[model samples]
Target: MKTMPVLNTIKKRLSAFALGVVDLVVRFKRTTEKMFLPWDKWVKPEGSIAREKLFSRFPRYLKEPAGSVRCGEGWYPLVWDLCTAIEAMEHLGMPRIGHFKAEERLGGLFVRVESGSFIVKELARDAEHRAAAICEECGEPGSLQLGHGFAKTLCQLHAAQRKPHKVKTVPIPENLATQRPKLLFLDTEFTDFDYPQLISIALVAESGESYYAELENGWSREGCSAFVVEKVLPQLTGGEFFQESGYAARRLREWLAGFGVPIRVVTDAPGYDWVLMLDLLHHELPPNLYPTPLNFYSESLPELRPLLKQAHDDACRDLSPHHALQDAEALREAWEVMKEHLHPAILRQYLKL
Candidate 1:
């Protein structure tokens, strides 16, 4: 009966050795580590394995491959020195038994003898494909779509789309030309009066013989009818003296770009209106605008009278402050009130008129 225990022990030892061989073969065959895995996954590093023991010590191999030590799909074979074989076994859970290099098993995983050569090639190919798909504009993944309209692997949102150009027209009054540069009148309407939140800008500028303008985005309910009536009409008619809004600032910055000269953006108070212009030019305008500081301050216009009285009364009674468009109109009215009283040369020094 005692002999039966010894005989059973010998049988168990032989079974363990056989099972280890199976672990080695299955892991070695599926070795694609030389090729790139998907971006979402990572591989265990090589060189983490200790020296291999004789087949007897690993008794669990007799039963089955350990469910706890299951191999990941991405693991590949690497062989040369025992150290690499040991690394594959311990770190990557790969086969380390037998002379795989001599048997040509290693060649199945890698073209060369280098340990990580397979992974290197696969990763390189994936990187090149990713780089080719990136958009030059806006710098977001798949934002730009170019070339073919069909036969694609990635989603449309990840692709870039081309945008068209649009341009609009606005008039510049002849009277204000003498006090400021050949100016561009810009304006914007917002859905709300919230700071740093702009919905759209309406710009008007003179290009050589004709005037050009455009709106950045179409006006919304929060920005349109009331804004045009309360804001736009006042500036055009010279009923108010200040209309400091996002639309005005955008146009001012755009104008400053083409002309190398600094522009004096006239407002009712140079201090108040100019401050708004500086903020728009420095912080809000696009990179193409290339804005620098320019002179801004309220230069009292020639026409000062019943208009000022009305403006002051409105300011006191309305509670809500009138902005840039109103100021544009007020400036026009003020000039009409005093244009004949001012020196012609001084007017010529500041304005194109």
Candidate 2:
């Protein structure tokens, strides 16, 4: 019986060794690491054995498409490395790529897959290191190099292109042409009066598309107004922002992207809330992707919310004031009523552009 058990163990070891030898043979035959595996789902790396161990570890791969990060179209070549890792993770039983993105940092990329399995974690960790070896510009073979003061992972071609190019800042045009602005009215609920810390924010576009999110962490009903505690707190509890500090912010940015730039945004508390909103998104968005920061024209549009609220209160139907989307809708309603009474040109004077 003992001999039989020992023989079975030897047989398993031999089988594993034979499979490893076959993987080696397959790799030896391949010309490029970028080539797809026999199963079209995988794009194996040059010297990586990670793919070989995938299926056995996680057996339930999601058939649905895992999403890709928007690192601009220029970096598409380098993106394939992580995409392949994402696919391998999928085959190993995680369906969705949680987040694969290039951070504001100079080198390497971030890989986050949803499965949270040990093998998937290993794959992501390995990909993070391998990214530095891939060319940042052309996606060819590359290595981290220091030329002047800064270091970047770039090929010889791109490195040459990085050679000091003349950059000029264009001055503001003498005659400024203006486009008829599309205004999305926005509102925010926040903690306290002194600092007016942000809690929940919401916006409704002229097109009826609306977004609302509560900043999840480092916030409380304490030190906030009773009206805010009563009105905003209940609505904020289940919001996606509470899921992550930045989730709601990203969703808002995505919603804004739907409306094209020179995005003229209006808020009730521009002095306080508007600044708070920008502060909330400072880390979440890049400079190029940053939405036009808006301020409430406190001088001209002072008491704008109160006037709108009073008008709303006089109406047959009343909207609960101070809730973000409701308040934005109130602004929309008030604007419609105000425009009917006065010309839009005059209204723009009050809006302060």
Q: Write one digit per residue (lDDT tens) for candidate 2, span 71-137.
A: 2222343344444444544544565645443431444556556655554455555556666776655
Off by over 4 Å in 1: 1-196, 199-254, 269-337, 344-353
RMSD to truth, every model: 22.6, 14.5
**Which parts of model 2 have CA positions greater than 4 angstroms off?**
1-177, 223-227, 235-241, 283-298, 301-309, 312-317, 351-353
For model 1, residues 209-247, the per-residue Cα lDDT tens digits are 111222232222322345445654343322231234445
What lDDT is obtained when candidate 1 is compared to the true structure?
0.33
Could you tell me which 10 consecutive residues in candidate 1 have the lowest summed lDDT? 67-76
TM-score per candidate, chains pooled: 0.27, 0.44
